[model samples]
Target chain A: MKGLSKDRLWAIIVLLPSIILLGIFVYGFIGRTVYVSLTDWGNDPAQAMALHPVIKFVGLDNYKELFSGFLQSRFRQELVSTIFFTVFFILGCLGAGLGLALILDRNPKGEGLWRTIFLFPMSLSFIVTGTIWRWMLQPQGGLNMAPTVLGGQPATFGWMSSTDAIWKFDWNKLPLLTASVVGLVLAWVAFGAFRRAERTRAVVAAICAALLLGWALFVGPNLHLLAAPELHGFNLALIGIIIAAVWQMSGYTMALYLAGLRGIPEELREAAQVDGATQTQMYRSVIFPLLAPISLSAMIILGHISLKIFDLVYAMSGPDNTFTSVPALNMYLTSFRQNQFAMGAAIGTILLILVAFVIVPYLSSQFRTQEGHA
Target chain B: MTARAERLTPGRIGMYLILLLAALFFLVPVYLLFATALKSPDAINLATSWHWPAQLNWGSFRDAWDKIGGNLGNSLFLAVVSTLFAAVLGSLNGYALSKWKFRGANTLFALMLFGMFIPYQAVLIPLFQFIKSLGLYGSIWGLILAHMVYGLPITTLIFRNFYADVPDALVEAATIDGAGFWQIYQQVIFPISIPGFVVVIIWEFTQVWNEFLFAATLTNTNSQPVTYALSQLAGGQAVSWNLPMAGAILAALPTLLVYILLGRYFVRGLLAGSVKG
Candidate 1:
């Protein structure tokens, strides 16, 4: 270290500020936040008490309260909503984005104009998009009234206010439901692995499925509900917010897919065409499979956005609407508005874990793949 | 396949129609934003909610401006200052990491990249307390600092990748010319980084301009950015569709203009940002 050149020494000096700034402001703050989250900083420190609030190390009590406490059911509900929202949002963006990208890949006239128009919404702030969609999705008017102008009855659906959730059931049944779902996906994965003759991977997936199904059948815990049958399901109210998010993000997906589609060598498609494959068949058999990497990356990108969704939901549904409450929004209100810093941080930590669940794997795999290619 | 000719068959027409419909779907919200923003309060009545105003009303924009003008100024001030700071710092860091590679530079850059994915929510609690301790609790400068901290990751990544493309011989030549690290940056490195700077500026400015969580939490009414202000317009008890719509457009103007004028760069920035980031 002492033998380093003058320029190298100067480089170290020049880089010190960012190193210090990001280390403190970014990494240090995260560490500090996680530490604070473990403490009893402001369990009920509403208003004046927040300034000199009680701060104590309560360990993971906040987490326990959120996941198992009776009154903190909202957190669990929000967790479920986030999962559903992420799925729907990713699907919406991918489907619409792929469709748009496929169209643009044909190199039609006005391609530049259409591409720009398609991707422009990705530029606007979420608050603005949310505002526009709020007006568009109002219960009494907006999209509903378009029918009445044509001498038809206006739709009575409460786009963002509907409290009814689909597939709702007792909270006690949740473990069973989740285990079944996990079991099914594992079974599918196992079957694929078996067909491909990947013995170890197939056995691993089969074991996972067996464990999940065993839990569903015997070991799953029954959560005591605040209500006799606490139902958690797809909240119809979030549909509007989901639509707004998809609208804002689909263009981003479109650009990715369009680039990917263009990158596919024309010879591949030409060969398929020469083999007498129909256009749809060509896309289905050849093109779409080639776009798998694009889809994976898109899913990861959209998954994170959907998980940390705050502004869009806040702007569209406002603070008062709990039915459409996402984890980020709930975290905001919990920490800032309600003075439950510990609880809010717990929620934030959970969200971080959920996102990390997706992102950490994706990023590491991507890096590995890049390294392999190199 | 067949020859280069693409005959205008019914299928071609159908594709065009589908694209047109997608275009319409995308345009509806932007159209509604302008239409509602320009409509008078009376013209925003139920039956005419989707109608073009009987008369073009610029008054609503004025009204919205009067309410949020200060916040808009704060947003501009913070975004510009923060963006400038982030870009410069990012340029310096990027230059050092990509070119003057020392031991652990790649590791440090990887560590920094982790910051990009940290959910702001995870740090909001401590960041607020930290801001308070630093006496920046309710100030726009606080927001600037916060944005810089958050903006560093991507900005650094962008410039790092950009600078990586700079041939090492250029830097080596500058070294032979008796240039110091900063001197080499000024002459050899900075000139080629204009495009990188553009991408970072547009990316950070748009992000910080449109950011809501930090602004809402960190600032008071007097110092809040327009994102917070626009959100307040909607979240306020009285949902005045017209004025809020106007405020939304006003708040969105800078980013929207960036998109409209330099959209190609914006898209390019976004693409590069994600792939590399």
Candidate 2:
């Protein structure tokens, strides 16, 4: 009994420092950031940088301004850019990664060598990738001149500095669009649940879907996120950034999919083969279905990455380039460079909330699985 | 090999072609980095940017070295020291969590895991304040401290998961021999933890070395890591592209070398740290 108590004591002693450090650095600091975000510490330029700045509570104004203030359209546009970037980044990575993994699953020659070639980019910092890609994407020089080698005229596409945008939408319609998207997703989930005969899940999802769609179709059109029709779209400049990001991250998804592919039993493939299933049918029906979980996980991870992206954009187009800016970059420039501490904290808190939405459920599910195994 | 040989058809040809094209797509920027770095400032031009250098100019590397060599040293110091500290702390935490298994340990670990997924911007403001209060701001030590604290989650999670596989029977046997927690860890767990240490060390080293946000925000010019210096070099206006290319290579060399040499463990660490377990 004494020995057990002693060992337990030692265990607690050993864990004490890490527990304290994480408490202060992670949880405590997060609370402090949240509190800071609720205060007006930066509206006064003179007091913003003071050692002991006088501050007052200003609840939700910073967030309200970010979403709706006339002078803060840049923040609104950045939010739009982040959404488009996340969608496209996840899609590009998933598509490229699945293709590579599928090809490699054929037991290609020098498979390890090919994997190394593909994944080597994963090891380099985003800064290095950004620096190199910035040069390769130079409008006059690198890729634009590649066609010249093929005896074609030099192409004139501006890679990173383009000001053009496409698929423009009114900011006033954001609430409606968001509700519709959620409604559609829930409806799809409910349909899948109903098909699987999961009655409770189907009913719950159906009810939620119905409620959301009803609200969206009936009440959402009356709501507006902005006073006027402020336009936002998928900026053409993000295509280059997206390509560079996909290049750097697609290997990660490829690795994940390759692992998932390898985990499936060979007997399953042989069974399908003995049943005289063609290659395409076997893959479509068998392999891709098995890889769905991996694709979902990859999307979550890649989505969060694109959501909080800073360094790559900073290194490529720089902090001042409003076209390529993300909330993270804006937070840095706002808080550190401009000394707007409260505003910066607000942006950071918003980013944290966005990440938590994706991460919390994922982590809880992971923990549930861990508990099941234990 | 025989089965693969028998399957050589038009589809195989197309697959190989696709793989080759993908490989080229990935390799083009690397080739550009090297090609641009080898060219003289005067020789770099839009028309001939894709062409190989007429004469190799190693001076660009030399110039880049002169500009960013100190930052490289700082990065080396930061990565090595912080990696060592985080690895040791992670091992201890993993030991306690895995074998100790106290009340609420799993819940505590779950909370810690949440720290790893945060965007870092969320904690930047208060972390900056804390570091400044400690008077460690704008120094390499501040960056090291930050890395150590923030690095604990992934490192601890990896080691805990690794140690979970260490077989309770082994620890139990040691305990039966009258070994306490520390003694059992030292005699049994620690010796077998070499592989775990390798994975954690490599992961943390590569992360600390290649990391930019903390290095960029926390460190002064003299204490900046190679990534920040490379960013400055590249982000500058109207400079010859050769310098930035060379700087990029210099900044990337350590992690790339680690990837080349210890790639198996590197991938293991990557998969382990992704929180799927």
Candidate 3:
């Protein structure tokens, strides 16, 4: 036992540098960031935008300011836009990626050549992709002017400057009203699930709906999610960035889907064909469901990238372009540029939690799977 | 992979057409970049952005090379150095964790991997201060350290997963033959780590080379990597489209070329590592 323990100790010693370096750089830095977020460091406008010797413990004031207080209004708006961007980006990438995968999966002409062309963007950095797409989506000069080269009319539309969202409602001041609508949608979904006999999902959804409806109706119009009645559009600017991101990532998802497609044996498709399944019907009913795991994996990857998008937005719109500001960029500007170190840390903490939400469960399950395999 | 009908059916033809259109869609941006890179300043504007350049402006590449060449060199140096450092450390850590059968090693691994999930934003402030305190801030070496530090988790994860595939019997036999830790590593493990090394090299090389945020925050003008340098060219006030496009190509081509040359390992590297996600 002593010899075994000694060997273990030696092993630990051998790994000490990795453990220590990761400890300070990773874990220790996270700890320090959290601590800094609590302190009122670098918040003063008149003070030098550097580390403060006489920093005071502000205790979530920075978070409060960003969330509801009037100082960091742009931050809150940016956060909302990030949500919109991520949701739409994921959808766009999945659709295009899966579509491309399906096309490639048909064993088309010169398949390897086509596959390489599709996946080529996966090789370029976001900075390069962003530059290209920035030029591509330049409102006056980019794809809009393609009409000109063909002797067609020039595009009159603002491709990346349009501010109109596909859908907009004036519920900014009516917070309770928005809650009720959300509650009703949940209730409807729960009701449908109940009809479908998904008991657990129904129960959870019902309870959430009940809580949201109860709060909205009883508490009335006071529970606010926004600091002001700010207009949030799908920012035509984000389309350019989204186009760039999707162009870059669709290839990756396509590759994943191709791998998934290859893993599916040909016998299954033949069986489906024997069942008189039409091509569209076969894909919709048979092939699409089988690609769920690949879809989930692709969504996870795209979600993470969209959340941490800085390079694409930076290269496309530049830093001052608030039309496509996201949490990562906001964190950078607030801390390094604005000198609001604590608030920046707060944003970073929020981003960490956001990333963890996507990653932690995936990792936990991955570890479990590896353990099972071993 | 698909169940081909063994004939050019209308559906197959349609699929080919769709693919060709999609290929053209994907190629347009790269095409624009190259075409714009070739054009003189007056040849490219709102009306002409999509058209071919009037003349091949080889001078723009020269101009771009002159401006961003130094930073590109820095990027190549930092990426190679950091990838080497991180890979070696990760390889050692992986060997110990996989073969040493030590207590607390799994816990240490789990702890280290938690770093992989952390958004780099979370650590920027403290990391900046920490590097400054160490008197290495604003230096290329500081940028390298930052890359190595963040690169540790993914590299360690890859190496660990790779080493875990090795049979226990080999290590046990090595042990019984009086081989010590480093001795077995040198003789039994290091020789066979080429594939694993390739995976980590492709992974970390692309990551550190394309990495911008850490380099942007940690380094000064002399130390700024090519990724940031490319951004500077784009954001610079003068609308010198040709040079920035050329710089973007210059910054982008190394990894792109590496992908073309070692694409099999690169794709395997991507599919194998969910640690990034």
Candidate 4:
């Protein structure tokens, strides 16, 4: 018979505020969101009720409209873009991050300098990241100046302009040199070169920061003037968002991989080397197998973040920027921007359903492993 | 690991090579910020092969400070309050879920786990509606509420794993002595859990301080957090790049200082017993 002491009650009382807030603001809203998604509220509160909104007993109709591309008309397209963004984003961030991790793990001479350089971009908000990247992608800004300097004509084409020319090009065979390709290809090509080139490394390294600043300057208003091409008229804005996100988040991935790399058993590597396993084999078979768990974890986290990415896209494209849409952004526009609260809530619930599908199984597996030990 | 000791093998060189290349990929953007911040605006605008800033413009810091509302007061306030709230409540929630075997405890814990999965953007609309409904919209407190909701799940998860490592014998002893929950928690439990507490505090503080989405969407004024304020500096007007750079540096300084000064704690706190898996 443990008695509830006065302080115990007080402690519980003190936690009441937080608990109440979480229960209502978090769990409650989620429930409401699910409920609202079932209704056909449309854009007007009047149609909410007049359009059969008795809490609208339409079971799965909203979900149908969402998938069928009927209700919002833009839902299906947005979903496709969201999925693409997620795939590219996850891979890009992980690749870049791992590459960064490998580089920084060498215990470089100026370790702090490199660490600070990698992490500083993370300090800026998504808005800033979006703004900076927008500037760097501009035809007249720092980004194009390189081409102009290299005896090439200055780029007047706005990569983010419209999607018109895209559909005409073979989607599968489209040149990797697309505007969205800027961050990924450039990071891989230019940055990759500087990474491996030793003596010139120091020289290029000295100039690397200037290049980043050049990109940052173009991230904001410069992005707004981007229009559509006459053909596909697809917004390349999504590409910029993905690029910026990968650039910013790769550092995080690198840090995680670095930690994982450090945890590898040295004795195994030594044994492999003594047996004459080549560097490629050691990495491919041994090191890679060992890094799997960390890699998987990184992938999971990166995938989840990519799926839910909004800040970079929203800030760069804005509410009306309309280059592309992720699930979160779609949800935001439906609710706040378009006044279709019910539809937005529905989209949110769908996102939650997707998130739950991934998270619940992973969590349960983890819990089971823990319980096995217990 | 002993392979490196055996000889300066080609493999080791390759490893170093890989490490160097990876480092460059990660470090460029950060380096650029410093280079640009130090450069005069005129030089920055000039496309002359992107060299180091001709002369250091330390005044960019001053410009950033003024443009970003003259100080980082709003950011500091939101971060401090959110961090403290998350730490205290998270620890308490962890304690309740871990130690107090009340009815629905497991269910409540599982329910709270959803906080991590629901991205800030997903809840932005409903949350905004909810906050506006509560009449707390546009206030720092509103942003605090939003951050706290997400902060709890992670913080509690960390503390729960940590508290699970605490043997039940001490708690049982205190209970047998009629010392009740609070007494055992304060006298017997907390003092020994300093390491876990530090980890929770550090993680929560960084999460709150570095947070952007809620801070930006929930509040619209300079009275918002530094992340949002710094963001607005760039988005608001066609001001000098130096101004936003100042705000960027100022916004970044607090976490950077903590990382530098309390680095050991930051590092240890990061990888300690607070388990996510």
Candidate 5:
């Protein structure tokens, strides 16, 4: 009992400071936010609210307001945009990252140098990426002018500007091309490592190169019409954005793949080879199957990140541009700029549930399994 | 076709080419940033993308520097102070939780863990309101407190995992030698924990430095960090692309330097934190 008392005293001494800080600053703050979301806490809620003393015990009225088709309320638009951005962003990043990783895995001479080059964007904050990409995607910026210099006709379109926005649809004002392009750009900037089986790497490389090159030269040009159809030539903003996101995220995916790759028992591959299994068969049967867990984990993390991505979208889209108005941006404006704190918190609250749905379950299972194994 | 078909051949060149092309594709935006930064605004405003500047203008960097408070001092200060605070407080908390096994130890640990999954965006509005109420709104301390929330989770995770591996026998011996908790922690636990400490410091500093959402939303001028300052510089109409580019390069330098300097440690730390957590 004496020894136990000493240990207990020691625990209290060490624990109290952090508990106070994190509890108040983090968990406590979140609780306050949930409470705030429930009430009319905005700058002039009485004017916006239908009732005086406007605390809507509407339970999920704030959430239901998200589906409200009011032009002033861009809630549903933001939700749809977020969904598009997350799904496409995840697929692009993982796919491109895996592709890059496979190529780099061939034991290239300058592998470290290549790795550093690819990883450079990840180190740059989204602010830097956003600021720089905004400039590059401008009509006279690098993306357009580079082609003109090389004898191609100049692209007289700005991807982000309201006047030159990609979507022509007006009913929903759902800027499909704008959001998709921005998402693509974010993906390119995020993914860097894209690798798979070395044996199939060359074949895969040939197929991917042909597809990418063909897209760049042919399909990419046609898709540019989606950016600013009023302009004669195709706008490459959406494609460029997607490419950037894929480029940035590929490295992260590749890293996961590399970890999974290392985890593969060498004996299985050798045994497959000895059993007259073809190289493709060895990869198809052994390597890919074993990489499923890593792949699933990577997808979940990336998907959640893509949904909550604000920095990249903010950076690339700039505040004034309609294209940058992702769910995060929408929530920020609704709460801070538009002075609709309750509504914004509602969006954030919903976003939280979605992100949790994506990450927590998978992470818990993985961690629990790891603990069991340990 | 069956045996040596797997051997390296002309087909190998295709793999190399694909990687090289993808590498070039990945580098295009970075190259554009560098190219635009070096060029005159006139050069950037031209009808064609200039690969090399007509003349390298170092003056834009000077302008960018002045715009962002002439240096990264504020950012450096915020990052250093906040990171140090997080590391110290977090390590102490983790040691207690792992070693003590008190009545509410598990509850406290779980509470800290809960903060990890809640998106920063969720509490952002209320946090702003709370900060405003305390009159700490738009202050360096506000930013620091907010960042501490982020830094605490990672720092606590690192220390808890690291201290978990430390032998309990050594701690017991210290208790018997008339050493109190602080004395044992300072004299014994700290010295052996230098490597873990380095990882924590570097990780937290990088995160705080590179953050934008809080820095932009929390503070305005007179207390703005470089990241927020860079945003303001680049946010206005008729943007001086060259100057902002220069500002970005300068702003990114510290985080980049830290990452490069601690590349090996950073990678190990990341893998350790992720896998261990």
Candidate 6:
């Protein structure tokens, strides 16, 4: 017993340093950033950089301005672009990764070489990928001239510097749109739960969906975020950024799905074969269903990555290019370059909150499942 | 189950064709990087940018190395020191969490894992202030400290998951034979931890070497890593593309070489990172 107690003591001793460091750096620094975001620390240029400057408490003013202020359209558009980028990035990666993994599962020749070629991009820095892709995507050069070798005319598509946008919407309708989306998602969840015979989950989701949809129909229209219609949409320039991002990240999903595929027992395939299932039916019914969890995990990882992207955009299109700007890059420019510490902190906090929304639930579920196994 | 001779079916041919096309898609930019890097400044024209260089200009690489070679050395020092420190700390943490089985250890580990997913921008402001207050800002050591601190979560996670697979009987047998926590680790756990160390080392080294945001923000020009130097070299508006292309290859070589030599372990690290226990 004495030896066991001593071992426990040693365990504490081994774990203490990491616990303390993480407590301070991860949690404490986050608290400090939140505090800074609530104070006006950089309104005056001279005082902003002083050794110890006076700061005033300004609760939620910075956030309010970011969402609705006339001069902050860049932030609003960036938010819109981020949403569009995340959706398309996830879709592109899933499609391409699943395709590659499915093909590779057929036991093709040179399988190792093919995987190396496909995944080598995942090993490089975003800086290298961005630099190379920037050249390949130049509007007047590289890809535009690829057709000349085939005795065709050079294409004129603007890969990165384009100013066009699509799917434009008025900012005034944002509240309504958000409420409707939440309602629809809850409704879908309730339907799935009902189908699975989970009575409690189904009833709770049904009630939430009803309440949200009713409130949205009755009250959302009056809650306009903008005084007038402000157009925001998916910028065409993001196509270049999205293509580059998908190229770099799709290999990761392919790796994940390949592992998932390999984990399925050979007996399952034989069972399907004995049941007279064709190749396409076998994949659609057996393989794809088993891979659903992997797809969900990949989505969560890829979604968070797209949400906080910085270096690729910065390298491809420098910080001043508003068309391709993201919040991470904007935060850097606002704080370090422009000395707007408070505003920068606000953006950082908002990004943290957005990431937490996606990550918190995933982490909790992951750990809860791990606990069950333990 | 029978060992039948393989046949050249149309389906097989189509699959091979698609794989070849995908391979080409992935390799095109590499070909472009090399082709552009080999061209002379006068020979680099928009019309013929895709064509092979008529003359191999090794001078571009010489020029790039002259500019960013010191920064590459800085990156090497940073990644090595930080990876070593993080790996040691992570192994210790993994041993405690996995073998000790103390109360709240699992909860503490889950909390630590959350640190892995946060956007660093959230902590950038105060972290900068904290480092500056310690008089370490604008130095390579500060950057190394940042990487070590931030890298702990992932490294610890990987090691913890790796060690969890080691049968508890081994640890218990060591304990029964007059071994304490450190003794059991040094005798029974440490010997088996080489694979975990390899995975963590490759993961952390590649991450630190290829990282940009911290390097760009924390360091001055004199202390910048190769990624930041490459960014500055490429971000310029009115420069020859060959210089940045060559610099990209230079910045990417160390991690690329690591990937090529230890790809199996690298892929294991990649899978271990995302597929949480």
- Sorted into a CAPRI-style docking class, model 4 comes out as acceptable
Off by over 4 Å in 6: A1-4, B1-5, B275-277
lDDT of 3 at B230: 88
RMSD, every candidate, angstroms: 2.8, 1.8, 3.2, 12.7, 10.5, 1.5
Per-candidate Cα lDDT values, in order, are 0.85, 0.90, 0.82, 0.64, 0.69, 0.90
Lowest summed lDDT across 10 adjacent residues in model 1 chain A is found at A365-374
Candidate 1: segments with Cα more than 4 A from true spot: A1-6, A46-52, A183-209, A221-228, A274-276, A371-374, B1-6, B169-180
Model 4, runs deviating above 4 Å: A1-20, A40-42, A45-65, A68-73, A100-124, A146-236, A270-279, B1-20, B35-60, B99-107, B167-180, B220-222, B262-277
Higher-ranked by DockQ: 2 or 3: 2
RMSD of 4: 12.7
DockQ of each: 0.61, 0.74, 0.63, 0.26, 0.41, 0.73
Query: Higher DockQ: candidate 3 or 6?
Result: 6
How far out, in Å, is residue B135 in model 3?
A: 0.7
What lDDT tens digits, residue by residue, belong to model 6 across residues A204-298?
99999998899899998788787888999999999999999999999988988988998999999999999999999999999999999999999
Model 5, residue A311: C-alpha shift (Å): 1.9
Flag the better candidate by DockQ, 3 or 5: 3
DockQ of 6: 0.73
lDDT of 6 at B196: 93
Interface RMSD of 1: 2.3
Per-residue lDDT of candidate 3, residues A282-353 (tens digit): 888888899997788777777877888888888888888776788899999988888788889999998888
Candidate 5 per-residue lDDT, tens place, B144-196, comes to 87887667877887887788888888888998897777887888788888888
lDDT score at residue A299, model 2, on the 0-100 scale: 81
TM-score of chain B of each: 0.94, 0.97, 0.94, 0.87, 0.87, 0.97
The parts of candidate 3 lying over 4 Å away from their true place are A1-10, A49-52, A163-166, A169-209, A225-228, A266-286, B1-6, B100-108
DockQ winner between 2 and 4, please give it: 2
Cα distance off (Å), candidate 5, residue A171: 11
Q: After superposition, how far is residue A330 of candidate 6 from its true place, in Å?
A: 0.8
Ranking the candidates on DockQ from highest down gives 2, 6, 3, 1, 5, 4
